[model samples]
Target: MNYIIIKDSQQLTEVCQKARLADVVMLDTEFVRTRTYHPQLGLIQLYDGEQLVLIDPLEIDDMQAFSELLSDTSVTKVLHACGEDLEVFQHAFGCTPTPMIDTQLMAAFLGYGLSTGFAALVNDYLSVELDKSESRADWLARPLTDKQLDYAAADVFYLLPLYQQLLEQVEVKGWLEAVEQESQLLVEKRLKQVKPEQAYLSVKGAWILKPQQLAILKIIAQWRLLEAQKRDLALNFIVKEANMVEVCRNEMTSLKEMNEAGFDHREIRRHGNTLIEMVKQGQAIAESEWPAKITRLMDNPAYKQLFKLLKDEVKLASESSGLATEFLASKKQLNQFISWVWNKDRNPEQLPDVMQGWRKEIVGEALNKKMS
Candidate 1:
């Protein structure tokens, strides 16, 4: 198990040069993010057709060449379950690899499974049992062990072979373009930053708040977003959602009031006044400016029956089209569809993926027929 460790400008330059000439390469990253808003990149693993290398971002001074290769349009970037890896690459190089192939998505496209792991894919395709001992290694440590190196290398080493097979199969099924479109959209979303004003929508239990309380929740949530980004801290590190919701619900106006509202956090003591100020500003907002109360579809017997019918339609479509049921529409997506049809005001663009693209042709028509 031999591989090169690229820790300097010259080694990186050579790797980038070789990568540009290659038609496709496997990519993976190691990072730690338990304490921060963004994962701290520790290692990047790459596999050209013949060589495997690990790039140590902690030791490398310049990454421009590698970044260029990532953004290079001609080279196909191969990865597995790339949601978090795409984020890591965006943060590390301020760019995302394009013309990508996500083996996980490809597997789903082939009706294998919705969220297949890399090890499972390897076992299914190549009969290799991937070693999992170093999967949880502390990659940020100064010296990554040989076992860790082997594990990391194995992540990308099998990807190229997997990609070749998947490409041929998808092309035979006439699904190559559809798969690429889905992966491209997924990468673009992972690379985009969430807007502070829209951050409240991500807070848990937000839908339970009344219109005015939701206004306060929005203000506090937005402030938490900005503070988290500024300090490179997790949102909960600044203020937990429970405490933020409590403050907004009770209209806590001071540090003493925060305690009275049952919000107890050590970090809150440091920023209690700011939280109160945000609540006060939110309260000052005119009634007309308050957001409308979120309308959730009730779990009534009648609506439940409709949801069941929709699921039946999805299953029928999956069987007819020979696509994975999970890929066509998950239970979660079905619930979203019910909410949109019942509420009538939810954004059409935010509708489930089944309602658009190739999925619409396969499953959405059946579901829509049931609705009518």
Candidate 2:
């Protein structure tokens, strides 16, 4: 397989022209992001059927043409486990590829289980084993090794053919539209800014906090996220959630107390004053102004029974249909359904936005039937 390494604007333009002619293209990216809020795009590998191109973003200044090709509605972009890759593209190019297909999703729709890794999927579907030893190679390093180039090239080279096979199977199974809808959500731009006060919801122990403590933690978490973004560093580097929770629970008002709680000393030394101010601001907010408490529906026996019933039904349906139970309806969806059913006054049609298509088909009808 001949692979073309595109390191300049001219090569990018030439490749974009060829890519625009294809009905679909396989897309993949290589990056390093362990330390940062955003991925550092090291190499972009794309296969448009006839040519395999490895784009060196470091050497190229203008990727506008390539970006346009991605956003073109006429062309479809095929990827495997593409959520992070899609996010990387949106961050770098300010656009996402349209009409995308995620082979991982396709595999699940065909009963290959949710969350199948790329190499495993390749082995199962194509009977080809992928060399994954270079998975952690430094993509940003100059003078790419022959083995590293081959590893990157292999990602997209077989994807075109794999996509063709999956497309046919999904169409036969009549779940193509379902997978497409899910892919649309994956390709959409992630929120650039989230309210600092709402950040605590992502923390694992957030539910353990009282409303007042939660409000304080929310403010601090939000501040930490902003700081991380400003510094282009990971959130934990700015402040870990465990320490934030400890600070809020203990009501640490002074730098001395904050330091003793195992919080990063440097973070305390640098942002302690501002953190104290935010905590005070959070405390000043009225009780009603605090974020609403997350109510767990499973705490009620009636709802728990309903949830179990839904889970059993989903499992039975998955077995009969040869699809993963998770593909039909997730645990979160089941809980949401129970809550909707419990609230008699709430309209049944207004289920969570995430409840759609095959999920709606499998679970929605049963829910409506049970409620009636």
Candidate 3:
């Protein structure tokens, strides 16, 4: 396959102009995330119907033209499993490609199963074998091997054809709107980083912490997030979660107990004072200000029956709709729905995804009847 390697601003501009004229553009990205809070974009692969090109982001001085092309509303951007790629674009250009459709999302709507790999989708649709040997290649290295370039090229080469078939199936099933809504929601969520105050919820084993402990974790998590972004270091490199949890659990106040709190002396000299102050502040929090306990309906035997009913509804709905079980109604969404129904104190007006949109048409009403 013939592919152009674009290493300069002039070539990128020319490609963007050509891309603007095309009806659809297929895109993929290669990046490294081992060291930094944000992915370091190494390469970008683009296919505009007739042309296949690899643009080296590390070589290009300015990416404004390419970024503008991505933000273009006129042309549709087709990608497969695009969550991380979208994140790369957001970080690189400060804008996300729009009017986007993910082949993976369409495949699920067409009943191929959710979370299908890009290679599997291509092989299933096009009868082409994709070489993933270079899938873990060091894209940031100065000289990329021919095999590596071939691997990158293959990602977008078959996407256009796959998009066409997927599009037809989605249109036939009358699910184009749902696919678009889900894809758009994903893009929006990726673009909007979670707030620092809400970051603690993302910490592993966070739900195990008491309200006061959670308060401390939240402060430390927020500080760690900001520091990671500033220093371009991974969160674990800054402070391990287990250690942070330990400090929170014991309410460590001084650097004297640094080792006992599960943090090393090096970590202590760097962030001990600030972390201790956050602990003190968290310790001083009023009882009313502490976070509410997270209660699960699954713990109750009475609610267990209700949970089984909801699960059965999801299984039946999945069979009826020809959608994957998880796609139809994830366990988390089902739990939320159950909570809404069983707990009168929970908001009925606030429906989970399983209870809204196309899902409402799938199993929501039936589940609501069961509750009634």
Please report the candidate that would top TM-score against the real structure: 1
lDDT of 2 by residue, 97-126 (tens): 787889999988888878998888788779
Question: After TM-score superposition, what is the CA distance of residue 29 in candidate 1 from its true location, in Å?
Answer: 0.5
Compared with the true structure, all predictions reach lDDT values of 0.85, 0.82, 0.86
Alpha-carbon runs more than 4 Å astray in model 2: 188-193, 339-350
Model 3 scores what on Cα lDDT? 0.86
Across 1-372, the per-residue lDDT of candidate 1 in tens digits comes to: 578999998899999899889999899998888889888898999998877999999998999988999989999999999999998888778888887889888888888887889999888888899987887778899888888888999898888888888888999998888788789868876777788888887787887889899899988888899988899898888998888888877788878877766666675678898887889899999999998886555545677778877888888888987888878888877877776666665467676666777887888767866776
TM-score of 1: 0.93
Q: Model 1: runs farther than 4 Å from truth?
A: 260-264, 299-302, 338-352
Better-scoring candidate (lDDT), 1 or 3: 3
Top of the candidates by lDDT: 3
